[model samples]
Target chain A: MPKIVDHEERRKIIAKATWNVIAREGLGGASVRSIAKEANLSLGAVRHYFQTQEELLEFAMQLVQEQVTERIMEHIQSHLPPKDQVLNILMELIPPEEKKIEMQVWLEYISYKIRKKELQKESVHEVIVEILHRLQKAGLLKEDILLEEEIVLLHALIDGIALHILMGLVPIERGRIRYLLEKELNRIFVE
Target chain B: MPKIVDHEERRKIIAKATWNVIAREGLGGASVRSIAKEANLSLGAVRHYFQTQEELLEFAMQLVQEQVTERIMEHIQSHLPPKDQVLNILMELIPPEEKKIEMQVWLEYISYKIRKKELQKESVHEVIVEILHRLQKAGLLKEDILLEEEIVLLHALIDGIALHILMGLVPIERGRIRYLLEKELNRIFVE
Candidate 1:
């Protein structure tokens, strides 16, 4: 009998391998063969699940969004205070100490979107606006801050911090990202 | 009779072509042939000016820095109020009504640096710090904002706005960018 392969587990392994490849060599350097090699699997096995490189890349990008959403959902379900939950969601984008690879891989995917000229992915924008709206409902947003502008500013702030940290332009410590997120949110929200 | 090409004028033409190509097709698509076509020049004519793609790209990036420097120097020579001069320098990076191509190309170059793992560009950071220090000397920076953190934050804010504007993540109008820059400067500077 042929060895049994856990399909779901295999997809997880491939997704992780894709992240490693992107983090190390960038999106351009990733290929089915490279991902397979990174995952220690045969190319055929990797391709059996994903028909094309674009498909695999889409999967990887979705995984990045999913991971971020899952983490944020965990915080939301914990019923943290509105400000704390909002800050937690924003801070999650700035990967933790051990999760730098995820941020690198996410950036690679973001770059890929530009390279491919596929800028239609608005899920992140929607998720951010949703959280900000929740904060507004909770009376956390400052009355003077326009809701739409605040949402855009929050998204831009989070993206800027994530990019700068990934590029190593700033030598900020891990927890400092959270602190900055808290500080910026505090500046925008009701005292 | 053979055509006479002014070498300096020819370089300027090629640089503009390079910017157009990058803004339209991104860096990966900006090959010599494409740039030559965009410039309405023979490939040989373009190659005579720049020996390699890397050289052309380097020239394009250096031109970005030089243009910003020239504009800022003009302001520095104006002997305006320090806060006004600082805002002028910061706003230069955002481009005017005419030089939007330059900002797009600059962002492309910045992205190239990250993808190539050559993230050693520090001129932009230095320029921001230099201006902010001028503000601080003029007794302009907000009393509570940490100087070092302010530098990094300003850098991130400017970069994030440029990236967003270029990527169409925000439909921020050109004048509105100046307004936003001024508002951000006011927030950082004295009341």
Candidate 2:
């Protein structure tokens, strides 16, 4: 009997390898062949999953996004108070110890997009909007805030903090990212 | 007599060439040979000033800093009011058609630093603090703001805005960067 391969498992493995390649050598080094080598898969196997480097990169980005979403979903079920949940979700967007790879890979994707003169697909924007909607639904969003402006500001704040952390321009004190996250959250949300 | 060379002028020319190379091929492509070819200078001539690629990259960054300082000084001499002066100086830091090369090269340097796991020396920090001090001296700084946090926040905001511009994630509207800058300025300053 032929061995059965779990396609999802194989994909997750490939994406992990893609992130490793990006973190190790930047986007330039994450070619399909290199990612195949990193994943310990044959070139044919990698190509069977992703037809091109761009496809592989896009999947890698989605993997990052999905990891954040999964973590947030796991945390949201813990029955934390609404504000704390928002804090937790917003904080999750930044680099904690375990999330460092995700943040770095995400930045590499952004840098790649910059070099290509393309805008990212606004999925990150969607994530921000989704977070705000949840906050509003939970009655945690402040009434005085201009919703659109607040969203843009918080998006910029998240981008700034992540960039700072990845660049090592800011110290990675455990609570420092949370501190900034809370400060921005308070500006737009009622405690 | 040896060929007369103004060391400072040659250095500036090489730095300009360096920026062009970085803009064209990223930091990875700014090797000494390529930079020499870009500048149309002999490899020995280029090596006479910058002994290694690392030294050449560092000098390119310093050139970026000097260019910004020169522009700000010229703007300050225009005798605008302190608020307008601050606005002009801050705007000079972002891409304004003429400064796009500087912004791109500076970002490449930053991305290079991130990959190298180094912290930028505090020259940019000094510039931010200097601006805040001028604001206070001009009676424009808000009383309740935490100066240090505000400084860090403004630095991150400037960085975030520039990254957005370079990424084409944000439209390059002339007023857009200024809008973000003014929002942060209003947060920290009385005006």
Candidate 3:
């Protein structure tokens, strides 16, 4: 009898293997052969799941986005105060020590997309805008804060800090990330 | 008669060609063979300036850093007010329309270095830290502001914004970048 495999499960596993390959060698090195080797699956088996390298990469990128969104959604549903909720949600976007690989993979995907002129929409920016809008609706934001500017500024701030952390260019530790974010929240949130 | 090339000038030209290759294709596409083709020189001619592709990439990266630094230094020496000067300096780090190619090349170089575990010192971060310190020393910064935290925050914010701009994720125009940076400066600098 032939062995049976769960189609969706296998795709997830292959997507993750793709992430590993991307994180290790960048998008350039994430060949179908390498991904198959990393996933411990035969080339034919890998091809059965995703027809092309672009298809596999696109699926992997979506998985990364979904994972981040799922985590952020958990933070949003928690019993934390509005300010804390927003801060926590922002923190989810910037990778911690353990989440570094995901961030690296995402960064590589982003650079590749930009060069290819794909111009995909970034969900993180949309999430930030939505969160800020929700806060404003709840009367949590200071009246003086310009919602549009804050959205742009906060989005840029988070991504910039995340990039710095990934590059290890500066000594921005978790403590500093939290402290700086809290300060910004304190400035914009109603006391 | 054999052609006479100014050694340093030829090297700089080759480095610029490398930047063009990196910007058009990711760093992975920046092989010496392609670079030689891009520079309209023979492979041996290209090797005469740099022994290897690694050497060429490092030189190209250094040129990007120098170009950015030179622009920032010009802003620093300007007669603009301290706040305006700081804003201008920050603006130089985030590429405008004309400087997009340079910024793209820098981003790729940074990502490539991180993957290689090279951990090169980022001059932009150092420059930011130094600028903030100068402001504090000049008594331009608010007394209550924590210099260290501000340094980390500002650095992350600028980089995040730059990344977003480079990726075209958000519609952050030059005016918006200026507006946001000025706002941050306004909060930190004493009127």
Candidate 4:
């Protein structure tokens, strides 16, 4: 009998390999051949999971967003206080020790998405909007600021922090970035 | 006698080609061979001007920075008023015109420098420090904020705005981004 592969397990393995390729060589290097080599799978086997490079990249990007969301939700659940929940959500976006590579990969993917219009699908916008709504509903966001400007500022703040950390300009302490975020948040939102 | 080539003109041609490649195909595609093709020069001719790809890229990056600095300074000099100078500096960073391509290329180069440690030379740091110092000396920056934090926030603000413009989430209007920048500046600097 032929050997059976657990579909979900295989998907996870491929996604992890995709992240590795992105972290090691950037989004440009996350080609099918490179990812297959990184995953220790044949080209055919990699294609068996992802039909094309775009499909693979889209899946990887989705996985990254989902992973971040999952961690944020989990952290918020553990902390009952809204302030702590907000703090945890910001923390989840920073370079978690074990997930640093994933964060790096996600940054590259987002940069790519910015230049490439086809990549800016509704799903990505939805994810951003959903996060903005959550923060607002939690009353963690400033009510005085327009929701659009606040959303823009929040995204810019996070991206700015991520860029600095990745560039080694700022120390990679979650507390430092979170503190900065809190300061900015307080400037806009009433306590 | 062999024909003489205008060295300065040749250099400008090559640099323009480099920018074109970066705008079209990104930094990864701005290889020596590809740049030569874009310049319509033989590889040997291109090499005659730039000894190596690294040298070529460094010159191109510096040129982009200089162009931006020149524009900002011109606007400052022409405006005479400090508030207008500050507004012009912020407006110069936004996209949706000829400068849009330059901004895109600069973003790519900045992100590229993050992954490549060898590219982080003293000159880059010096340029950043000088810009920060000039802005602070102009009394445009908040006095209470540490200089280091001020520098970081400026970078974040620019990067954030650039990313949003590139992502199409924010409309590329001089008034829109400028208004946002002015608001943030007021919050940070003005009482």
Best by TM-score: 3
**Per-residue lDDT of B1-191 in model 1, one digit per residue for the tens?**
98786988888888889887876666656788998899999999888867665677787777777878998899899988876777777777766547767776665665556656788756777888787777787777788887777776777777776656555577556666667667777777766
Worst 10 residues of 3 chain B by lDDT: B48-57
Residue A96 of model 4 has an lDDT of 57
Assess each prediction's global lDDT (C-alpha) against the native.
0.73, 0.74, 0.82, 0.69
Tell me the tens digit of each residue's lDDT in model 4 across A32-110: 8998888898898789877765677776777787777787668757946665666667666666557766666666665
RMSD of each: 3.0, 4.2, 2.2, 3.5
TM-score of each: 0.86, 0.77, 0.92, 0.82
User: Which residue pairs in candidate 1 have backbone atoms (N, alpha carbon, C) closer than 3 angstroms, thus clashing?
Assistant: B140-B190
- Worst 10-residue lDDT window for candidate 4 chain B reads B119-128
Residue B36, candidate 2: how far off, in angstroms?
4.7
Interface root mean square deviation for model 4, in Å? Answer: 2.9
Model 4: lDDT to the true structure: 0.69
Better of 3 and 4 by lDDT: 3
lDDT of prediction 1: 0.73
Give model 2's DockQ, 2 decimals: 0.35
> What's the true lDDT of residue A26 in model 2?
66
| Candidate 1 residue-wise lDDT, A1-191, digit = tens | 99998888888888999887866655556789899999999989889867676687777877777888899789888877777777777777767657767766665555556545677755566788788887788787778877766665667777776677656677666576678777778788787
DockQ of each: 0.41, 0.35, 0.68, 0.43
Stretches of model 1 off by over 4 angstroms after superposition = A49-53, A115-117, B1-3, B49-53, B96-101, B142-144, B172-177
- Per-model chain A TM: 0.89, 0.86, 0.92, 0.81
| Candidate 3 lDDT by residue in tens digits, B1-191 | 98887987888888889888887788778888888999999999788767765676687888888888888889978998888888888888888877787878877877878888786678778898899999899998899988877887788878887788777765657887798888888888897
Candidate 3 Cα lDDT to native: 0.82
